[model samples]
Target: MAGVESAFPTKRLSVPTADPQPSFLVFGAPRIEEAEIAEVEACLRSGWLGTGPRVAQFEQDFARWRGVTPSRVAAVNSCTAALHVSMVAANLEPESEVITTPLTFCATVNAILHAGLTPVLADVDPHTQNIDPAAIEAAITPRTRAILPVHFAGRPCDMDRIMAIANKHGLVVVEDCAHAIESEFRGRPVGTFGDFGCFSFYVTKNVVTGEGGMILGRHEESIARARILALHGMSKDAWHRFSDQGYRHYQVVECGFKYNMMDLQAAIGIHQLARVEANWQRRRQLWERYDQDLAGLPLQLPPPPEPDTRHGYHLYTVMIDETRCGIGRDGFLEAMNTARIGTGVHYLSVPEHPYYQQRFGWRPDQWPHAVRLGRQTVSLPLSPAMSHADLARVIEAVHGLIPA
Candidate 1:
């Protein structure tokens, strides 16, 4: 199908003595409201602003949103922290290995190392940019204890296949669900699929508590342990000690990290959580518009996935077809910027980074497909706030950038 040329308003947006290139069009800015402000003020004025009612309520809201019970979720300060908690929950040995993709954010690999497990690299599917289930199975060794799969760019990974593999090998599954808060796979929410799901609420994510995360688990004991792990191993969170229990008796069973979410961050979530569906719809609309408009472009767009799998559109990434466009990925990024659009690369391969290379001596040949994509995939602006004009601006920018 031929893609539409542009979705810009017929009337050009008035620009008064503009500087270079549309004032650096942003990617995923938050859409906060007065309700958020009021919540923060209430939290402040209430005299108990730590991990109080707001954080507790946010955890409940998050659980309800994902169609899971409260025992399934525990709030934390960052997804990285949540991942660390998941690793601890798995009880992986110091030399045990966790297989994951090379094309994800470094945090995914870093969490493995932080948990005292070896981070094993695996190749990704050329199309999905997700860790191939076959490759994950092949990477398993006697020391392999867990399989960590990233739901890349809010698109659901192939969970059924991955779960089957993990089940067969008796390996724990830890999901890196940073970009996929509202995503579903085969009618089931992504966070509810695995033994542990770690979600990020960083500034760029679908949901924004500014910087926070939630670790979801099925068992009560696991979630409780995660809560303890997140709260410095304290038996009493502020919620239970003061607000709920009205008592000070606390216990500390295990050593843990200080990773609890603050009341201030929870304030933003109380408001944003209500609008999650609306925001997701907005992103879906923008994705469709981009898909319709960029149909025949030289780039290789993400193809439709199987039925019942909803894309959160956390990132509308595309790969540069050097063979077709005559321009490689880096050159394409430069060209796009020149045409007045904002773009970003989701990652350079985790192995390609200096720290990993120097420490592990990881060569590009370790994960060839990931190496190829590390040089190709560029994330286009895909935010709920992005309007039709914004989509048009992106389309116009890409058209001008690509060499005909």
Candidate 2:
């Protein structure tokens, strides 16, 4: 397919680079400072490292940051864990259908399937590459019980329309906020709009805990249920059982997975959460630089946020036009690698994966927008750890490699 140029294109800039960069620029290195190091050290010193006070504090602090009550948050091992527990809390019957976007990481769909629900893929919007609310509404059927919308590349989906459709259909809404810790829709955080918001703190996500996640909800009962489910369905978590008061016995209430986040991870999260906004500011500046520097290239930069929305700027993704750029997306990635600049693909559309294709018999052409984006999209390195020189190297490498 031909590359689609931006409507407001600028003159291309020429940057000369005789040699590849001396050192490889990794795509998503966690920005670990003295504070993160000290916090983790403190956890090691404390010895109450397994799902203890630090995890409790992180959850409380996260809830306060999101303007939700502390009881509304449940800390887990990964966003996948959060999503799975949220689905279980939703109490949907086995084989119930979940309408979701195809333009997300497989974990989003995998959670649905793991929860014994059918994943019904909805095509994405051509511009935002987000689940189109119209497509979601169209895909809903009598068997549909939930809607899982991913905030792709940290851009918030059209929640107003999605919420309206979900409300009209009486469907559960589980928001996949893996890339959207800093994203907001009309002043409200992305996760707060849905019935349950699942957030990631993976190495590459906006916030880094190495590997952790949180689930946010408004209802106390559901949040309590998620808390129990996250820790193996125990009547009492270890933190409560072995507290200074006494050793309390715990009973298994139901069969559940061990998805609790450790205090060691939460120690990192506590500090990461503290500086997330500042880190987001840095990423926003870098995103703008990429926008200005790569304006006229044979690429489609990520869409800007709509009015009144705040983008997380988690991943600076661009779609390559092979014909115009004189290279396919994979070729572009290799070229970037040769220049010692690391890059990534946010995802291939869920149905395009071999597992999904063979299991569901999904065709790539069924969701044309998702298929196209999946084929063309490439994520440039965008992280708080990136220095100004690192940004310049990436910009220069991109300009030098893509044909004018």
- lDDT values for all models: 0.87, 0.92
**Which prediction has the highest TM-score against the true structure?**
2
RMSD of each: 9.2, 11.6
Candidate 1 residues lying further than 4 Å off, grouped into runs, are 1-21, 244-247, 338-340
Candidate 2's clash total is: 0
Q: After superposition, how far is residue 322 of candidate 1 from its true place, in Å?
A: 3.4
Give every collision pair in model 1.
none
Model 1 TM-score, 2 decimals? 0.92
